[model samples]
Target: MVVERKEEGKEQLIQRPVYYISEALIESKQRYPHYQKLVYAVLRAQRRLAPYFHEHPIKVVASTPLANIIRNRDATGRIDKWAVELGVHNITYESRHAIKSQALADFLADWEEAQQPSSQADLRHWTLHFDGSKNLEGAGAGVVLTSPKGDVVRYVLQLRFEPCTNNMAEYEALLHGMRIAKEMGATRLRCLGDSDLVASQTSGTCDATDANMIAYKRAVDQAGASFAGHIVE
Candidate 1:
């Protein structure tokens, strides 16, 4: 979705950026065709032309039931997150009965077939390894997810915050690692980490007594629940 200007009954394009779906986004179990398009449109527009959106009014012309899908009662997880992010923009959606402009027609045609990579789908169990380390310099975390076909994804996250405890850093690492695994369509996950307390709490083996720990525990649980099978050690 690009910002357009109407001049003398002509719709002029402002900014157009091509958005390609990453492997992580393509494999996300929670993504649907419609949801993916809507999210991409809103997020791409926001990222590229945020200042313009803040200063001007924008109208989204679409024939699809985009409003209904985002506002659906069953919407949760990433869909909910995207909707909340889009709420800040002053935009309205109107159904266009016809495509009067040639530019809009072309744009729609290109966007329609954007993210369909191929027909083959991969189904395999994935292993996720995460660890959080803190030292005098700083605190950071790393995670690696290895698929059955040997496609390994390694993510290194540096945690920057003053007055942060070691346990808090461990929880943050687990939360981020689980999110990556979920996005990559890991239905069956074997989670490995050195933080025994964090892993045990997330797996429901140990109780979370601290307020911060309780909140982190809930976040990890929600992320893991999307998977069919999940084990932490």
Candidate 2:
């Protein structure tokens, strides 16, 4: 989770990062407890950054005592459903201090050493990359993936139908990065891409005589047979 934006720079305010959200933890939330993983990372960043917490007023720095333990009034079960879902946003809470910029203290020490915590045999195989373009600032597509413990996950798409083509936005960014690496359970994926006609018509050694590239190569061969080992470099 990242969401910076401070600006002003000529001799003052700086902070940069725009938005990045990452979750992946369910195994009983990797055994929470560190103030319930800081109120489950601010209630999973207010439910995955709900439109930037419904247009910003956020401020949650944290050194603990997270807003008096979510306004504790003997908060019960799951901290009373996370203080009633973070009391409908307009949040506040600060405290964490002392990092007067040495390039924002080396980017929060390399984003807290890339958020440590690895092993599961270092997260067995996952790496994807995709791209698509349509020019004139329109049709979009992009997907990144990574995570063998390197964790990357990025996505962006826009192709709002109506005549899209650059190999149909590279098979819609390789079927939107194989449905976000099979919803992140990724049973070994690899799929890097630059689109040699969408990686030779989705790996059938090229032959998609355009009827929308044969229905996007049969929906990318049924999303690469639901991946249990995929490849399409």
Model 2, span 51-164: residue lDDT tens: 888887887777787888899889887777778878888998878786433554566677657744355643366888898989877799888999787879899999988788
Residue 189 local lDDT, model 1: 74
lDDT of 1 by residue, 1-233 (tens): 44345556556544443322221222233345775666556654664466766877777667887677666768886567666767787877777798645654566667556533343333445788888878898998888888767888888888988766788888777778778877876666777788878866764445689998888887876676676556667
lDDT score at residue 209, model 2, on the 0-100 scale? 86
Badly placed stretches (over 4 Å) of model 1 are 1-124
Candidate achieving the largest lDDT: 2
lDDT of 1 at 209: 93
TM-score of each: 0.46, 0.28
- Candidate 1 similarity to native, TM-score: 0.46
